[model samples]
Target: MLTFYHAPNSRSTSIRQLILELGVADKVKTVEVTIPRQDGSGARDPKNPHPEGKVPYLTDGEDYVRERAAIILYLTDRFPEAGLGRPVGDAQRGRYLSWLIWYQGVLEPVTILNWAKLDHPAVKASLRDYDTALQRLDEVLGRQPYLLGDDFSAVDLLCAGPFAWFGDQMPATPAIRDWVARCMDRPAVRETAER
Candidate 1:
């Protein structure tokens, strides 16, 4: 059986939601672990495969997958029957992959910096500011309901996870707001969010 290590309300929640969206909840077992707290006083679960004791890591048999983007890509590709991944030769596959990489590479860092108010010229130059990220997302979302276009995919869920949680940090773009709303409206997302 597949094992998923996660903590409620943490980055791992997105993985949980993705599993739910795949309708493979019964196929995998979820192991909840305490994450490192802001004060650095939480449990560093030995059972968790994450090197830093982070949540949202997945154990597939003897192999371990860490990082949100990696976990999402692993699960979606592993269970292609869910239709969440754009397989090879698909026209949208490139766009799909780009969104996945962009989420971790750009959006994640930008959100953290903006939230902490740690603005620096170098940081802005390397990893665009929050407003720029929002504008780019708005442009894509305005063109289609999901990152890969009309159909919802794991990219939608993965990308939406951050925006849904950090709605306050996002700009007042109707497209972004609507896309996030659509993502949150999914039954799987609501269930995982409640957990």
Candidate 2:
């Protein structure tokens, strides 16, 4: 059986929600682990396998997956029947991969930098600041309801993480706000948030 290492209210919530979305909750077991804070405040379980002591780690047999976007991709690909993943031959596969990668490589870092108030010119040059990032997202979302169009995919699931979790940190754009609300309305998402 697959075992998911989870921490309540963390990025792991999205993965747990994905499992529920796939209706494979019975196929996996969830194990809660404590990840020590960056300031070394919380308890860090020695039994936890996450290298950096983070939540949202997955152990499938001997295979371990970490990082939010990677974990979402792993789950979606593993359960392709859920139709949350755009597989290799799909025309939207490249776009799907781009959204997933962008969330981690671009959005996340930019969000962190913006929240930390580190608006250096060099940082803006590389990550383009949070407003630009949000506007870029809004441009795409304003065109379509989901990242991949009408149907919601894991891309939407994972991409909405920051907005849904951080809330007011995201810009007040209608496109983004509506998209986030739509994504949050998912039964699985509501259930996950309640936890």
Candidate 3:
């Protein structure tokens, strides 16, 4: 059994959506606990399972799973019946992994820099949009349908979740917004968000 330490109205919601989409709703049990980040709550302490003291940590009746991308990959791999990923060694799988990794790599840094209101002119000057990494991401998203291309996978959830979660931070993210809208309309997403 899997025990997901969850907090409503937080990033953990995406994991719920994942579990539900994978048709493993009954296999996993959620430990509901509100995480008041502004006030520092008990459930959100990183010491629990999540590395960053954030919601969405999972204990798979054995080992602890932290970070959204880790959790997604863990669940998807743990239950391959979900078909959330492409066939192994497929060229498309590389794209999937790349985008999934980018969620934590490029997305996190770009979002944090924007949220922090900071800039690095030295490197940014050489590239477009002041050479910011987010601008480079925007260029990629402008071309791809789902980050990995035409089909959707666990990586799409990984990328789309953060892209949607960080709304208004990059208000010009039309493609991201449209993708999020499509994801939100999915029955699994609606069910978890409502929960």
TM of each candidate vs. truth: 0.94, 0.94, 0.80
- Report clashes for each candidate as comma-separated counts: 0, 0, 2
Q: Of the pair 1 and 2, which is ahead by lDDT?
A: 1
TM-score-wise, the better of 2 and 3 is 2
Cα lDDT, all candidates: 0.86, 0.85, 0.70
Candidate 1 lDDT, 100-125, residue by residue in tens: 99999999898888888898999989
Tens digits of per-residue lDDT, candidate 3, 1-195, equal 898888877778888888888898898988776565755644444445656656788986668988887888788877877778665666676766666676766666666565667777642453223125445555766887665667567877766675577666565467667776766667887787666
TM-score of 1: 0.94
Give me candidate 2's TM-score against the actual structure. Answer: 0.94
Order by lDDT, highest first: 1, 2, 3
Clashing pairs in 2: none
After superposing candidate 3 on the true structure, give the runs of residues whose Cα lies further than 4 Å from its correct spot.
Answer: 39-53, 121-137
True lDDT of residue 61, candidate 2: 88
lDDT per residue, candidate 2, 47-103, as tens digits?
Answer: 678887787888898898998888888888888898998888999999999999998
Could you tell me how far off, in angstroms, the CA of residue 2 lies in candidate 2 after the best superposition? 1.5
Candidate 3 versus truth, CA RMSD in Å, comes to 3.5
